[model samples]
Target chain A: MNKLKNTFYPLTAPKLFITDKLMRLLLMGAASTSVLVVCLIFLFLFKEAGPFAFKPGLGKLLDSQWIPVSFQQERFGVGSLLSGSALVTALAMLVTVPISVLVAIYIAEIARPGEREFLKPFIEILASIPSVVLGFFGLLVVAPLVKATFGLSTGLTALTGALLLSLMAIPTIISLSEDALVSVPYALKNASLALGASQLQTIFRVTLPAALPGIVAAVMLGIGRVIGETMAVLMVTGNAAILTASPLSSVRTMTATIAAEMGEVPFGSIHYQALFWIGIILLVITFALNIVAQRVLKKYGMMK
Target chain B: MNNTADKFILLSLRLITYAIVLVVGYILFDIIRNGFSALNWQFVSSFPRRSGAAGGIFPAIVGTFYLVVGTIAVSLPLGVGGAIYLAEYAEQNRFNSLIRLAIITLAGVPSIVFGLFGLGIFVLFFGFGPSILAGSLTLACMVLPTIIVASEESLRAVPKGFRDASLALGATKWEMIRTNVLPYSLSGMITGAILGIGRAAGETAPILLTVAAFYLPRLPKSVFDQVMALPYHLYILATQHPEAERIRHMQYGTALILLLLVLGLSLGAILLRTHSRKKFRW
Candidate 1:
């Protein structure tokens, strides 16, 4: 096809038909625009948050007192929000990751073709539902159920948020982990089975280890999602911004803090900058995980 | 012993999978139980208030519609155009690779960060303070990457022969794009736009910063007027309310409506995707 096209066009010189300069320029221009958007966002966030960088925030960040009354006494405590987010996300991941990996293993290695076909789309539907809707469901149904079972005061708690988040994260973990497990070459699993290894043993010893990097990427993506989630956490987290280790206690998250405070915060103030600082924290955490995931993916890609 | 243990493990996994499915079903059923009972024309049309729990979601419904429309208006052109340029013109090199990386990065950026960006740029700098325009623009940016990637994949799927044939017939690059490629790829582009709309409709963060009035019982008079979105309303009614009875009704009704809107949009996309997959399958 390439030869036929060249013969027909009869290119006599470098610039005869399609020029490299035009293609490269267009590609470069498009790439530059995206980078520009990213740069502009970072610059805007940092410029707004410059003052808070100098505000000596070890005490403020560490302390539980999050009272930002005015510019005079602007002591914002993000410890609770950070810990709350981490707790909820950790709980959710604890529940989701194992179940997701199990399902991935089931579908990829154990399930017959028909079952895999049937179950995969069902999981995808779960992913397609928006987060806000999930929050609403949690608030209405899961929260009440938790309250009744656990004898809690209100329906909203870290437990409810974690439950909903687990559901949301499962799809990510399952899909990606399944892709990883599926991509592991058949020969390794076959050899393990031929050598008298049980199917589960084969998966654990050979296939799982081979797919370890991709599985890590999948779990990181799940963590990235939990950290960034806003609406669901805001709805079900009780939004109290209190520091608590108890899953039953009503607490707020870093993302929830921004959502709750952004509307009320005075423009270009320390309180506002504090929110940007949260954004900075979130960016750093997720960006680091993303880079790690990228390296893992690259390693796995090279393996394949 | 090993066989029995294996059987038990498989049984437990199957049970857990079934339980997850049941959870999803339970959520939908709960929503329906509350929402369906109150979902009359009066509830749909009238304004919500303290006394009238089932009065209406008039403002919220309208607000959501405006949000979807505004987001589509802002994101569709840019997303589709960028996808076209990327798929058609760009070579697979460092430049295109950078573009891909930017898109993945954009997707991972927290929605809360976008909310902050909206607060700083749209509400503060542009002075579209706490209005629909600000909310919509923020959502537009949020959905842009999804649209770009979806449309790009579809465009890339278009065979190279079509482009070659159009060029052979003395068609300019722009003409070929306008006529040959676009016609074939219209369904894919529309699907992407619809998926973008679905995402924008359910977004709470950007709107939380941009618009998302706590009250606003009345329907928005225009884009300038403050409005209460369904998700924001649910958030308020869930957390802020002092009364438990009020909370119950509000929570259930809001949950149902939100689920309907989100599921409606998402199911539409899934159906389209499934249909397209079937149609395209040889």
Candidate 2:
């Protein structure tokens, strides 16, 4: 295009023709790495976990006691871990979903142009804050506050973990569902307004419905984060592994089980195998959640 | 009456947003303010004394720096190459969608699972042991989805006319991408990488099983040697240490340092992304 263009490296016949096959192969291999990684993770988890995962009998998994480290009798029951994870995740979602949707609506519909622009990136920064740091906040700050507020013996209960996890989850929900709310067709909201609906009604009744799939996907992704979080829950949940769902009680989550115990266990021991089994269960749960979220995101034509 | 109801709802929403923002602000402020006392010249430079009670965290800082470098080296090319194939070359089909599905699934499969995978495969099957090499490769896998998604978005953001112009000047397809497309998208790609750096640096789980050492106060001589990291250091001090009450300030300082490191990188990425968007607009 330029009258006298000077190129540092000009393409030659050998260079042009020679790289086509190599480039194609390399790029193909690069793309396939994702699939390969996922497959290998599942294979490795199952291989390490299969023998003892079934040795305890599938029915025994519901025994409400997890004594994997017992010298007297080793049992690989996952009931308490599963329930504990569920309770923490449920508490997190109860706080995350509604507030996230509200924040999304506020940013997308109510905030001024400048405010919207400022708020979106602010949410991204919030999302970028690491989980371990949040765990730190929970351990030093929120746990003490929760203890003071409720007159509990210790602050590091399931509630403290849930509260911090909710904090960690909120930004993901906000950023994603904000995209969803923004993508709802403008005409739909305008039509509601034209038919004598209030601006709030237009947003809640029309725009929110149109964006529900995307919002749901966002919530699912947030749940995925909550369920998989390790450091924060491990730090603050007290790691008692009890068979209760009370928010005020100490608990242990499956992810926490792996992170807390993996280092101390002897290699190839039943305890080690049971941790891998926890890993397998975690993988399957998260995989299911993500698949549903991906399908919803794809169906909504919302991916940018 | 209608206006009053609408106004009330809007006010409530604004309050909720305020509450959420306040929590984040509170956490950051609490960390920085309480931990500021621990940030001294000696603290950042000297080695930990008495197992992380009163001394510095130089080894942990250096280890985290090395992990970031190793992660970028391993992930940048693979992520960019894969994204380029998807955005420029791959046809839209079931197989391509399956690839997308696989990437998303991998991303959401949890860091703890990645930790296990690293322990099983890298530490055992591949015989790398609990070293920087295993941790970096595992983190490379974990960050691949973020990098690929970001790179593909930026690549797609490049104007199609530039590619056409390059091809019209008798340039081959590869040459077109090399000179015209990549230059415009480079900022976005770097932004993605910076964000990944932040995540990789602050992450505890994947490295917990792979590379992080509990009490290695000295700097690592090579990738094969285990090293202490700020995240795992903080984890140990807060949760497992017998003297958790005694060295609480050091724990806050470590948290503050990790937070600042990750937050600084993320801030750079957000700014660069804003800059890229402004520059790429027609």
**Interface RMSD over true interface Cα atoms for each candidate:** 3.3, 1.0
Q: What local lDDT does model 2 show for residue B159?
A: 84
Tens-digit lDDT track for model 2 on B11-50?
Answer: 9999998887777778888899988987888988999988
True contacts kept of 2: 0.79
Winner by lDDT: 2
Error (Å) of candidate 1 at residue A265 is 2.5
**Docking level of model 1:** acceptable
Proportion of native contacts kept per candidate? 0.42, 0.79
Q: lDDT per residue, candidate 1, B64-156, as tens digits?
A: 888888888877877787787788777778867777777777777788888887777888778888998889988887888888888888887
lDDT of 1 by residue, A1-304 (tens): 9987887666543443354346445544644555566665677778777787677654566667566675566668778888899999998998999899988888888778997887887776677676877887787678999999999889799989999999899988998999999998889999999999987789889999999889999999889988999989888988887878999999889998888777777788778888888888887787678767877898769222
Per-residue lDDT of A75 in model 2 = 69
Error of 1 at A210 (Å): 2.1
What TM-score does structure 1 among the candidates reach? 0.88
Q: List pairs with backbone clashes in candidate 2.
A: none
Give stretches of model 2 more than 4 Å off. Answer: A1-14, A53-60
| Candidate 1 Cα errors over 4 Å, as ranges | A1-33, A54-64, A70-74, A148-155, A193-198, A240-244, A302-304, B51-54, B160-180, B242-244
